[model samples]
Target: MTDAPQTNAPEPPPRHIESAALLQGAREIVIEHAGQCYRLLVTKNDKLILQK
Candidate 1:
């Protein structure tokens, strides 16, 4: 029996999106998943926080 040869393949880069696009001029936005709600907030420090 002979084993198959292996090959190395490069992975694609991850997708990127701007925070302004997601928030759309809002301080917070709600996301729904698995029958649950989550809040994505932007603080005064210009950082992001995810809450359940």
Candidate 2:
């Protein structure tokens, strides 16, 4: 009767990172619209650097 669509429950966070089928350790994220993959590395002094 309502115009709203039904939605399911949200998924829980992963508990294990050692498994090869799952991903983990996601901190601050910066998405680029130019189709480039970037890895960021931080130091103790809060300095940001590009990671290999």
Q: Which candidate number maximizes TM-score?
A: 1
Model 1: residues >4 Å from true position, as ranges? 1-12
Question: Best candidate, lDDT-wise?
Answer: 1
How high is the lDDT of residue 15 in model 1? 81
Q: TM-score per candidate, in order?
A: 0.70, 0.27
Write the residue-wise lDDT of candidate 2 on 1-52 in tens digits: 6788867979898776442222234433443446876665445675556643
Show the colliding residue pairs in model 2.
none
Which digits, one per residue and each the tens of the lDDT, describe model 1 over residues 24-47? 999999999999999999999999
Each model's RMSD to truth, in Å?
4.5, 8.1
Candidate 2: Cα lDDT at 9: 75
